[model samples]
Target: MMNNYNKEEIEKLRDLIKDIDTAMLTTSTPEGLLSRPMMTQEVEFDGDLWFFTMKDTDKYREILHDSEVNVSYAGKSYVSVSGKVEIVEDMDKKREYWNKAYEKMLDTSYDDPNLVLLKVNVRSAEYWETGSMTKNAVNLFKKMTGSDEKDPSDMNKTIKF
Candidate 1:
């Protein structure tokens, strides 16, 4: 799938998610679907998403059971990414995305053996973005005024990665 992506489309998808600070990572459990907030790695969106996790965590176990997952982000725009995930243990890769805050959040250093990375190899993504603040404000006004017309400034796209 990665081989089929054109440079422009990848950049467009990257632009949509670039400023998102957190993503809701969802995995399937025996009971149902479970979602947890995950800190978004401050790196370029390169057809994959990276996350930090502990080896003993529920998400880790769930991923082992079913590698399929969903990750969603809401900022000025909203993005939902469906992908397959696997546990990654390479220390160098972990260090590349590491930050001091993670130490405080997980109560462990990056060097801890319990530390692991969730590598989400994106399959497909859908995003909805409201073009600009002014346009969004106008849309809001129209909605409040009981206008039934759809806003032209609203944008939506689906990308197969």
Candidate 2:
């Protein structure tokens, strides 16, 4: 169940992440697991993933009950990251995902009483990247030619993201 990926493939996965702006975060609660989609603008990935949320939200409470969580981001390409979610209440971090636009949208400062930042220390992730129609066609062509070459469409890379 392990296909070792190279540094180039690692970067490709990260690049796919750079394009998407939202993720559906699934959290485990005492009741059960629930999923909620949230804008990923506040997500700060420095090898260790970070995201902002409300302290009073159910997602936050669920994390408290069980740190185990799954965060998925996808579009043309897809990424599913499995890791532990921790609450980061640092003042400086509050100011990082904070912005004037965010204030306008949420009608509150980043330091608002309800605000919270969930840092996901991504340990490992799996991806299924079927790039585009052209890429798919190229993959088929490779198969037909018995090239056994990698086509961008059949990308399967796993990494810490």
Candidate 1, residues 65-113, lDDT tens digits: the string is 9999999989878989999997899999888989999989999988889
TM-score per candidate, in order? 0.86, 0.75
User: Which ranges of candidate 1 are over 4 A from the true structure?
Assistant: 1-4, 131-152
Give Cα distance to truth, residue 37, candidate 2, Å.
0.9
RMSD of each: 2.4, 5.5
Q: Quantify all predictions' global Cα lDDT against the true fold.
A: 0.88, 0.74
| Tens-digit per-residue lDDT, 1-161, candidate 2 | 01343455456656768878788888887777788886665453444466778777777878888898887888877888888877888888889777787777667888787887888766678888766787678778878999868655476867753
How many clashing pairs in candidate 2? 0
